[model samples]
Target chain A: MSECIVITSGKGGVGKTTTTANLGVALAQQGHTVAVVDADIGLRNLDVILGLENRIVYDLVHVIEGECRLKQGLIKDKRLDGLSLLPAAQTRDKNAVTPDQMRKLVAELKEHFDYVLVDCPAGIEQGFKNAVAGADKAIIVTTPEVSAIRDADRIIGMVEAAELPEPQLIINRFRAKMVQSGDMMNKEDILEILAIPLLGVVPDHEDIIVSANRGVPVAFDDESLVGEAYRRIGRRLGGEPDVPLLDLTVDDGLWTTIKRWMGLAPAREVAR
Target chain B: MSNPAPARVGGGAPVVVRTLSAQSGADGVIVSVRVDVAFDDVRAELHRVLGQTPERWRNRMARLDLGDRDVELFDVRRLVHLLKGDYGLSVTAVYTTERAVHRYVSRELKLQVFTRDPADDCVQALVGAVGEAGATAVTEVGPHAIDSDGVTEIVSGPAVTVEDTTSFETDDDVVEDDGAIADLSYDDESGAAKAAPEPEPDVVLPVEPMPIRIAGGQRVQSIPRSLRGGQSVRFPGDVVVYGDVNPGAVVEAGGNILVFGALRGLAHAGSHGDEAAVIMAFDLRPTQLRIGGRIAFQGLEDDIPRGPGFRPEIAFVTDERIRIEPWRGRLPTEQVATGDAPPSTKTPGDAAEAAPVTEQ
Candidate 1:
């Protein structure tokens, strides 16, 4: 059965698009036919992040208006045959396509693809509504900062109002060092405020930025730790409940253990 | 507009066809037609009357008046069908002196019928006003003319003497404006009829002072989700928000406001000058708050201490200034009105009792 999941966040620059792209790649890698829809419209970035921006001859608006066939507008991923990208139109705004139109498109896409991942825009406006309109589930991405957590809370309420099932949270760009030093909010603090199911966390990593800039999703990079996090999230999304949540604490091989033994590093809490 | 004169039909005896306009109690205009001839003559007279009237007044409420005549239901139904189907008039009322015809029209046809010699004067006035031509329907004396004495007697009777010692002056202005003239006047009389349970203000208000919760109880509008930036909801009464009011969002109400979540946005309660209205929220970190004539502007950097923990607070107008108190089943008396009153002799018990009751 096809499942539509919208990746949304009320705050901008919180990695909703990146999460959608990586999740799409990871799901496709598992042999599932996936269609990643960019619901951002005027601020389309999913195409560029998926390295399929140059291949778009027809966009979401064209497909919705019947100017182009759905297959014609779908840009097949260069790396994976099972994966495709429905690019948003750069010329049109969020209001160009309504929630009803988006629902119809998602319903049609569900007939062909096993997974339809909708990349929602930043604000909880028309773009967010369009993305969540047809989704069976939702994934809210947020940072550990107060502002991000607050916005995430607002988004969770909005998603609930849209009648979508309670969304899972993904803490993006988390800094273990800051959390350990009490400089930033810990996972527990964020969890207490959001009070949603935890999907997976992607720690702050430079490789993710580099991969995004290269138009390659971090999920495809085997050597990248962040990519592995995306893989775990994808498996969880694929109904693999046994997949362990990523540990945001520093995981520097034998160094951390040796330092702990030598009393050089502070004792690690094994509460979990 | 003189009542349409009786028109004469050629070949047959002269057919008397008269059309009269009456005003229903509900302010709707009702046109009545009296036919003193056969069914065929009535049709011809109706056509002549319809031709004489303007198009705007054609499809108005029409009533067929059979003055003391025993007409058959079939012929009446046919005439009603002609009025409704052909003339496009909504035949709501049927005036006939026959009791069987009245009962049939009221029951089977489901039309209002007024028989001759209406028992009650009030009912007579109402029925007479509906049947009589000219602007008598708009005279506003139909129900009042009969009920005025009963009302005044009930209002100025024992209840007025045993309770309020002050001279009561009836405010006639309250009688106008709202269409619930009958209900409101009755309520006013009943309110005066009841013995005053507590000492009230000197000026006798037409209506009893209603509790905010009961009077406008269902007027509570709720925003089930967070109001994002640039979004706003304006309600004429109390508002309850289940989600956070985001920084740039706004929620305005004409009465008390309650937020189940954080109030980070601009919230204005008591918008229409109800100073007693209060705004309560789980987290009251609003950017700005306006209650009636008072305004409280709070910034992000403003240091409102929450010592150990933050509790839900209520913002209300106290001594003509905005005061926010940690709502722990009641407003804290220790928490003095900031920027206005110092620690006063009023204890917490006094504050708790004073929160709900406000003197005019």
Candidate 2:
């Protein structure tokens, strides 16, 4: 379906851009024309994660200012079919584009793409307002912590106030062992505080950082657990039936135990 | 002029059109028109009269006599416009007996109007002194206008009141000026009658002085959306919020405060010191509750939902202190009151004396 969805977290450093890039790749890989827009005007990271940073010529501000056509500003990914990126201007501030311009841009993008995912900036400022102006749905990302959950609750209230449909939640960087050890909140706790539908959870993994450093989305890696989590999320958004959550508990698998007994791997989970 | 001389049409039959005439005096020239016929006939008659009068008379001040015939404001304004604009006649006063015509002429047209019977002797003598067309009598009758040349003397009309004469007294130069006649004799009975077109009946409004909550009340201020942190609302009446009042928000009302959702902020009802005002909310985990002048700091333990069920609660003043209770959906002292109140219905705030009903 032709729709625009904004991914936002009220607080920063919560994996919002990572989730957006992965979902955009996974959706485009499913043979759907998808456009991922970076709504963060000054601090843009979506193009870097999508590995299309070097191909940027005309950015969002240039298109809005009539300096370039919408097609000219859109950077299509050569690595994947039916995937494009609209990078934000890094030198300009959020005030460079208003909410009305973003709405018009999103509307024009929706006319050409099957899915338009907007990576919203942090906080409830003008940037946040501009990102959600034309979005038909919202996907809220929050980590399993009190501060993040509180901010998520506030964001939920704001998203509902903006008149979008009830946003589904993405519990990012969830650590099951932390919950088991009483060191962090569980998914149920975050869901109870935010009061939204749980879309999918991405376990805390090193693949996200590695993939981000290499300027590639983790969802392109088939064997990566985080990639599977994001693909399931993309499938759910595409009307796929519910898939079971990933097992993120301590490494007690038979293969892992045999490896540890053979002295090939460490007996304890590695410290961060 | 001589009443248009009763001219007949070419067929030698008398048409008997409405008459138009003019008389001049030191008070002003009076142009009386009997407009009881069609507007076309009045226009033709006015054109024929102006054709016969001396052209210099158009520059002199003129008072129009509407003469007991009902006239609309449109016809009056158009007639005045024709005399003032087309014929160049300066019309400053009007004489009409109808209150509606008088009100229109005096207030809307801003002209002096005399609302008396036309057959009065003072008006006739005043007409007689101005009988000799444009004669020398300065009929601006005052102590200064007495018998200036003796040939055209000020024949003070018998019906002229002392107050009328005193008000008409002007300087010697007033009779020579064009604008002096405009302010003559309009603040009399005519101005008072024109002030009220339809007589209004006396109305007395009932005022209430009590601060108690009656069965029916006054205005209720409503906020339809949630109040985020740092947002505050203050109202002089009862306040009803359809959404949550989040932490760090404040809501103060002179009457009862009602929140449809959670109230985790501070709420002060009866800010004007009406002690009966109560604060009600669906989730009443407030940081502080103040009713009237008394403030109560809420216990922090209730910040989390203590049980599985969520019920609306109420806070009100009890024994000079605030008391929070699980609301039973109905006021304990309120009766369904079908002709007679229930025996358990005490005063409105007597919740401590009655068994509260289960919340709906």
Candidate 3:
């Protein structure tokens, strides 16, 4: 039984694309056949994030419009086996595809892959609607900001209204040091408003940005904490509910390290 | 464009601009434009000088002090158009010594003109302006308008005139229409007539307060689910919701509004005009609260901070203004006696006190 999940965040720049790319690699690394479909249409980024941008001869639009077969559009990941990408059309508008076409496409992809992950676009527009059309479940992504939470709450309401099962949440770009200092919001604050099940929280780290710039998914690196975070979330999505959350506070160290950076602590001998 | 040779202007004289200085005035600025060039260059040079004003000065009323040059009627018209259209300045009055310009600009453009009298007529208007209310002018604060020891400043230009005597210590907040105030006084008309009254500077038309109306609810609407952003519920009667009202959602009713859960959205009770309408929420952190025509924006961060932590609040009109206080419980059954006072110890305000007999 293949379950297709659409990863969405109503607000842009909240890591919908990054979550889709990393989770796809995480699932593929677990030896499961996965096909991550980019539903952002004109703003297709799953191909770029998965480092499969250059190899696209056909796209989701071509598949939907019957110009090419579904196999012609699926780009295999450069690094991992059993992982493929159905990239959205860069030249076509979002209106080029319909919700029925997406449902049909996902139904076909499910026959070949174990799991199909659809990367949704930002906003509650037509592209968002088309992305949600084919998904069996949804994974909402949000940051610790008020605007992100507000939009997430709105997206959750929309997902329920669309009759999708209670969507799980992934709080991305979390900074533990800021949340610990009482400056930023913690997981409890977001969960209180959203009242949804938590898939995981990806700590804000340089690895994600470095991977994005280098056209590589962070999930390829097993040592990175953020990579582990995505891997845990992937396991949760894969029906392994016992995967524990990663310890994000390991980077925040003690107060001395914080004070030393601020040049406020008393002179302590440098150990290193 | 390569810094053209000292340009020969009117009367075959190659004139050049001398100095330019700006002084901050009430709600705007007063620019003292001193130039040896003729009046034809005032508009062109004004652009070069005041083109990129400070961020605050942009779109504000700017005063320009054009030198005592031969200002024709057409010159005033073009200068007014350029200053208004190009620089976004509201020129209030024009002061000129040319009696003929005084005749035409006042008749054709309807601009006010003033003389450079330091002691007699100028001081009389200053005293009158100071008496017209406790209007706080910059003159009283910095005392920059007038020089003590009874001395007037003769700013060097086409004509030596008292420039500081014009920036008055008068009704600083009075508002007036658009026209430039040129201060070129002639010895012939020094004591001939009164100075054109200072432009009315400060009178922003105050918005009239919305009058609260009296009306009862016709029906009661019950909503079982939470309202998300872009969703709204409007009814002609009271509204009761069983779920949270998320941000960007709206709940409007003609009578009272009660939310069982948090209200992060907007709640407008008394939509028709019931001033006695009250809004009670389990966790009241609405973006805006409206009781009748009165509106109170939840702008203060301390009043309704985002995130979790509930201290149920009830909003009602109590002294012509909507006031919010802690809500203990609702007396929905009318069980309390009419004459009995509300228990002040445990309750800040009960729902019975906020809801009047609107069912007339």
Candidate 4:
């Protein structure tokens, strides 16, 4: 049986699209056929992130409207054979597709793919409704900011209202340096607010941004730490019990290393 | 687009108009007039609606809702004149999203102008409000009006009196209209004519009390464990959390909220718009806090100190802005008298008494 998962965050710029692309790539890398559907119709970036925008001949709307067959609209990812994308129409708005239509589309995709990850748009509007409608599970994405966490809480409530199972949380762009310095919010703080089970924490890395700008999923790059986090999260979703959450603690300088070896420094204590 | 043929009396084109009659707090009726076209072009429609309204509704007050359009002073004055003079509808308030229209309606005409939410659908809004008051025996009216009996159904009967009274007291229109009247009488004209005669007999409009009843909720819902993210708890009266309100959790109450532990999630008190409602916690580091209509998010201040020094804080709406201060057991009346002046000592007591009402 295929599980349709919606990756959503109520606040904008909280890495919902990035998480969607990386997870799709991670799952596909594990030999599972995965389809990442972009539900953010007008503001689509999933195809670009998956490096398959140029290969798209027909989009989701075209398939839904029966202008093209579903096979014609599914753009195969350049990196993986098992992964594909059903790209959103950049010209059309979110209302172009209804929740019932999304359910039918997901049901069809279930016949071919093992997992379907729907990338939801920001806000609790038509886009959000359509994204959660077809999904059996939800993956709420948020940063370590109070504003983002607040929005995540709201999205959780909405997902529950939609009758989707308890959504998991992914904290992205987490900077341990700021968190240790008592400036930025930490994992504990975030977890406290959104009491949902933690999927994994993707540490803040500039390579993730660069990969996105270059039209590539960071999970494809072995050198990227965020990619490793995504892979572990992907394993966790695959029902692996032993995939530990990422430790985003900053390890800088020789003194900190010495303090760490001696077990003298508190975990959250900053070196500077 | 071709304009509809002009109406004989108003000389403006006949536009589609929708009039909604709703029950007021007082033993009377409140009607809202909605125009589909521009505010300036709604003269004929308003005229038609007002003309057809039953004579029994003559003394009732009505609000003009200018959907998505600004109102000029001339247009507002004309509507007010038509409603009050010809129809005796007593145009007391106008609702619009346009700032200029709000200014003209409030300042120039000395009437209340509510800043209507842009997302509000007229028919649905009335129905939603009526749905909340479903306990009140609603009667069917005309085709458009959801209630069939009458708008004044709640007025004569004591069955749904308390809730309706609460609704009336919190009704922004009644309070705003009273405020408008007070403002006009207190300004220039009253000062100029003070010595001439009996000081324009304080227009004792039966305005509801300022700190509207922060009392009488029989039950308090208590949560034993720390609320985790993705969890939500809502109660009609007060809510007491024995544990922390963790991040991503939501706790909403109609009255006030008291958290024995840290409030790190979204906490909303007075979800029904009672400005007197307050949210108090041992260490209030809420991601977002809402009291009545005012909302405040965390990180608004760059220098907010967290941990150990995390003093128990109380959040309440003051002068329309959500203000947070250390919960010092008692409201610092002398401090407020010397500093702010408006929120006196009683406010602190009111806040304390508001939540503890349902406490066993």
Which tens-of-lDDT digit does each residue in A1-272 have in candidate 4?
A: 78889999999999999999999999999989999999999999998887888888999999999999999999888669889899999999999999999999999998999999999999989999999989989999999887888788778878877888889999888776677677888777677667788888887888788999898889998877778888889988877847765555543344457658898764653111
Q: Once model 4 is optimally superposed onto the true structure by TM-score, how far is the C-alpha of residue B18 displaced, in angstroms?
A: 22
**lDDT, candidate 1, B19-110, per-residue tens:** 22232233233333333456776676455545444353356665555544445555677777876776677777655544434434554467
Q: What is the lDDT, from 0 to 100, of the residue B97 in candidate 3?
A: 32
Which portions of model 1 miss their true places by more than 4 Å? A91-96, A124-126, A145-157, A188-195, A252-272, B1-269, B274-276, B279-289, B297-321, B326-329, B334-360
The DockQ-derived docking category for candidate 2 is incorrect
DockQ-based ranking: 3, 4, 1, 2
Q: Candidate 3: global Cα-lDDT?
A: 0.66
| Candidate of highest TM-score | 3
DockQ of 3: 0.31
> Which stretches in model 3 have alpha-carbon errors above 4 Å?
A253-272, B1-218, B303-310, B330-360
Candidate 2: TM-score, chain B only: 0.35
Alpha carbon lDDT of residue A78, candidate 2? 91
- Give the Cα lDDT of each candidate: 0.66, 0.67, 0.66, 0.66
- Where model 4 places Cα greater than 4 Å from the true spot, the runs are A250-272, B1-360
Best by DockQ: 3
Task: List the pairs of residues colliding in candidate 2.
Answer: none
Once model 1 is optimally superposed onto the true structure by TM-score, how far is the C-alpha of residue A256 displaced, in angstroms?
5.4
Q: Which ten residues in a row have the lowest lDDT in candidate 1 chain B?
A: B153-162
Q: Tens-digit lDDT track for model 4 on B294-326?
A: 678888673365665667777776555778889
